[model samples]
Target chain A: MRISFSTTLMVCLTFVTLGCNDDQASVSLPESAKPLAVDATPYLVTTEPADTTPVGEARESLMDGESATLIGTIGGSSKPFIEGLAAFTIVDQKIPCCAAEEGCPTPWDYCCTQDQVKDNIATIKIVDESGSPVTADARQLFGISELSQVIVSGTAKRDDQGNLTLAASTIYVKP
Target chain B: MLLPWEYGVRNLARRPIHSGLTLFALTTVTLLIFVVVGFIRGLERSLAVSGDPNVMLVYSLTSEENIENSSISAQIPDLLAASLSATVKHFGITHHSPELYLGSRVTTADQSPGLGLVRGVTPTAPLVRRTVRMTEGTWPQPGEVMVGRLAATKLGVPTEVLKIGNQIEMEGQAWQISGTFAAEGASFESEIWCDLSDLQTATKRQDLSLVAMLLKDRTASSEVDLFCMERKDLELRAVRESEYYQTLQQHYRPVRILGWLIVGLVATAGIFAGLNLMYGALAGRIRELAMLQVLGYKRVAILVSVVQEGLVLASAASLIAGTFAVCWINGLTVRFTMGAFALRIDSLAILSGCAVGLLLGILGALPPALKALHASVAINLKAV
Candidate 1:
């Protein structure tokens, strides 16, 4: 009777654990390919009717997939992509000039302060011919150091959440 | 002067139904106390396991600063990297990770509204928070989201059931669950993390909550704090993650206090129920006690036998409850505002429950056992 009781108690506990457990180790992910290599000198001077759109304009700019050229200072340069994802968001060179307004050093979010969050910051990713993110990240292949000025040409796409992204076809370092 | 141990044990065996009922009553009390103590320990462990001491949260100087509301310049990470305290490092990385936080209403798989704390993190986030590791899938892509292991529990669903291929909708957009991450005992396990820029665009708020960096030197926190103080124009404040959580405990203080109050009330009622059970068990046995006294055993021995029966019943009940606790209660997750933490039934909790069980048994048997011994041996014998 004691053994029977113990077994029943254990069975009930196992059911309870299976019911509300938080471990996700059993959940499997879809199979994926090894990361793709990036092009060493992937940048090309494209003449695809591109406009010298300001980074702020890119924020409110044309719909996704339209080509545009932007001049900005690469920010978040210290470590752009972790490993799997190769993307970077850069600030327009003019963002620092606007610091003299009502706010000084802004809280990083920039939403709570009276001054507007700098719209000149644009997210950019280097993509292959099919427009998927390349395995070899911009920093890994091209040494896209942080805060450096450059003109990049890419398709302006809004990720499903409407975050502006520039899928780059060509990037030109300013001489 | 005590009766043989077998006499007390056999007396308990004589009325199996009464003994079972008494055991059950004591078990209920012991279980409640055990669960309550487990909750308090779990809460403390959750707080203790989170945040690096040197990894200060640099945010707006306002009291209202939280993950979602606090914002600063886009160049804040760069500014902090320049501060260069000797103790601070980003593991293998060169700088800190800037993150955005938002607490929004998320719908569960069952279509119920649940709270989700969404974090938009740069890749360097893991470098600063060294505890986090990917359990499944790769790092999140722009359109993808990774749910923490406890994220689903906080959303009132099973974590294992939240599959990797499943998509979750928020603000009229669907994000694929690409992966899951675990942070050991930290509260970060209850969050959903996506690419920083994607979240910024989705929320349409391009700002950051704070920057995080790993600290090697224990005293580096003060130096970081001093850096923030000097940069008052930056409107940033430095807070140790542990200290922040300790303060956060104050916010949940009322809940903890209320848990203890409920345990106290229920425990008192349990003791009374056990007492009533003992009274009823002994009420019918008054003649047996008088007969035992008449048969040459000391009155003191009869009293000892009755008390012995109480202890035996309590120990049996506690055994059952303790088994239940080990199998079911230990290591279970409890969800709250900050995140979900697992209920911990360490040695202390088990010992406490057993101690309470013994106390209840003694209290329950004392009054009736005394009355039975003192009340008229001759009157009882004549009435019988």
Candidate 2:
């Protein structure tokens, strides 16, 4: 009887002590995940991230049916600026040209967005409808700032002026 | 007692071949059960670990077979923002990011072509899969790509081959590597990333694979569910990202059940083999057991001794097989249709092996013990 009691006791203790879960990692959702009132504000929609293309380079490729996220400032005083609610400009990144840093393709010649290069700074316009900028709050559509890190996805089209025009399908203003 | 527990060990030493065979049988059975059950558990765990409860996956109602097959208008996020949740735009804290997925092929540096999954994403893709960290280099550019570390091995190329500055091509277009990312074992590790536009042009696919959304609140999933249910025009579906993998776990139940069946069959065979050995060995010991009974050893005590012997053998086999599983088989990676999962010899598996040993002990000893107990001392004396 003593042996039996001791055996049962040992077995129970072994189970209780060793059976603790090693991977009980509680997968809790983020605090922001708690259900909240869906704020009915003009919002940026997100999808799974796609590849990133510089705003300037995508303008050059103008591949038909091509869409991508353009990562750059939406509106800036340095170069790119919004024309109206429906039209905005993004600055293209400059590549160093032969140590002189002066060699960049003509900004007006790119086929993705309409922009101008002055004093080595390139700026382009993002229009609601390419070559036909309608009246819309471009500032409200894409928050303007040098830090307004914006990402937009769309098809590449060329305006009659041999300028790159991106018909944006999705736009995300950096929060 | 006629034979103390220590004598069980001595008895085993006496019949080397029979005891060796019995031990070997239990070892095989125990190892089989551990591996089969361990594999299922690993798969369930790896999938479950990949999702977050607050994140949601939205795809077209027409989506089936695989995520890459689903296509939606790129403007769906704008539509969802307008109709489903307004809080998404609150405070300029962007929670909605879109993703495009494509099933494409990769040609290795060795010129070997193989299947691969490509995801076109914005910078926010890593933010949604929070564990992901860029281990090297900057984010990708138009002519550049970021490779997931695991994706390298899955693509039949050395992981080092995917380092920054390396080149990989798909759909006749070449992409230079810009960086590598680690996602803490998340499924995102098995994909190659490129700009959404370039992927669309390269593959000629204008539709999206799916969109992952961080909700305004936890309750948004229910709202999203209701929205999907009601919005047939959109032909959309909404589910919590974490719960989606649970559905996948269920979908793979047949594979688990099949493993269990194999374990059950082999374990049963082990039990029968053990029973035969016990019965034969005990038949020869009946006279000795009868003599001990005549000398005042209770039949119950003798029965306990036989069971104890069986338990000891099972315990030994458990130890040997458990060691083998932990040392040799643990951490072995198995690739599934979705991704790879490594087999783990964790606590649960060890406990499972112990339970098998206990059951094996009782079943192996029971019949022979009963036969010994029922034999009369007079019959034994006359027969031998």
Candidate 3:
């Protein structure tokens, strides 16, 4: 079939435009940058798997220093990791960071010398998976800044004054 | 009582130089308007179609302008992403990639300086946004980079120059250029991408500038908004990708308005000049019109013929102007605040120019044509 000059020009232009778009669509991630498969078993925390009626009840059910998987969203900012447990809330015994006037710096920054440093630590109102409130100590464990999905494995402990705290020995992040 | 339009055409033909000059002036005005309007429309189209809607930009509330100024705790992204996944999953959001953007001057091994927008993106970013096309090599490795088409062109860097295994320095840190990409529009066509961690370390930014995520459904803007609002601690605003471009255009409103004002002022002058030209043509042929009047041609008929002459001139001028604009302005690249955009003299732009020309012709011819038609038939006959 014979095509006029203008028709041919238009055809070429259309091809060029489509070709440009197709070329752009093929951008690939570098082989080295591809995400590696993470072990989900290590990060699986079975504590209070189902939604509880209260927030802190999930933590109260755990025995002190007993291994329980804590499933929760990653908090703070940092590199992606499953084991990095920046912070978590236990049941009741929630100490408001404001009461840490005895030189407790914010948990984010540990300034032991400053009387008001402890005031900077975030205080969590511990509640069970059920609607009941429980007592727990707000413990700062691993520091992972970037928010991510995670499951932490740790032992639970209650401090003097009936404040429960989780001493995490091994933490896993669900990939 | 009818006067032939052929007489008006003949009058115009009699003084070819004056007709040519008037037509040229009209053409210039029409061309300028077409080019300016076309460019604005083209830029709007480019920006609207550039990026993916699924990509959300998470910048600091305190930091305005570029994302580079914003800083969050380095762990905030991972934490936020984890906490928000359930809500994001409820809305069917699949890919959430955090990006950190930093502007730095890059240099080749030979010390040639290249200005670039260095973006630190996740591996999944390319999967979410299909517009980013890589022409050669591969995506950036952990410490490697990928350059955009225009950036490569400007820096005179060949695809081969970015060896897959070689490192280049930017801000005293060495990074390898592992790939190259080109996009549909101009903005992304002039940038460079790298690994988020690599750029962060290079810039010494322990915190991410922003996080981008793609929604499984494009219509989930409201859902995303609700999710962000529910988590008052997150403190984010969700905007559609298209709406973001609209907001960007808002930044250029003053310049666009100024451009329109200039075109309007010039067009007004052209209209006046067109009116004078028509008046001169009619006055110079007063005897001819008068003879027609004495021969029983109605005054309205004479007026119609004069107006027809103006239309003919305008039609000719419109064609000339449209042709000039297409040849000179179409696809011509000009720099702007955001970046460079090519002039696009599409059908609408050309039609608007022609419409303006026609309107000018009618308005310019009305008074002169009426005056000629209103002259006394006897006086016209005497003059002839």
Task: Give the winner by DockQ.
Answer: 2
Please identify which of the two predictions, 2 or 3, would achieve the higher lDDT against the true structure. Answer: 2
Fnat, 2 decimals, each candidate: 0.00, 0.07, 0.00
Q: Which sections of candidate 3 miss by over 4 Å?
A: A1-175, B64-68, B73-77, B85-94, B103-116, B135-180, B219-227, B230-236, B378-384
**Residue-by-residue lDDT tens digits, candidate 2, A1-175:** 9989989998896777477646676686542333433221333455534686776666565564565566654432222333222334454545221222444333222322223321112123333434333233445443444435566666665433334445564566667
CA lDDT scores, all candidates in order: 0.72, 0.67, 0.59
Q: Per-residue lDDT for A59-140 in model 3, tens only? A: 3465655545454432211111122112343211122222355653333222232233221111122223342222211122
lDDT of 3 by residue, B330-382 (tens): 86665554545567777666766777887778888998878776767677656
Rank candidates, lDDT, best first: 1, 2, 3
Q: In candidate 2, residue B338 scores what lDDT?
A: 75
Q: What is the TM-score of each candidate against the true structure?
A: 0.67, 0.65, 0.60
Better of 1 and 3 by TM-score: 1
- What lDDT tens digits, residue by residue, belong to model 1 across residues B245-356? 8787777789889877877787788888987888888888888888898888897788778888898888888788888887899888888878788887766666667778
Looking at candidate 2 chain B, the ten consecutive residues that score lowest on lDDT are B225-234
Query: Model 3 reproduces what portion of true contacts?
Result: 0.00
Q: Which lDDT value does model 3 have at B35?
A: 80
DockQ of candidate 2 is 0.04
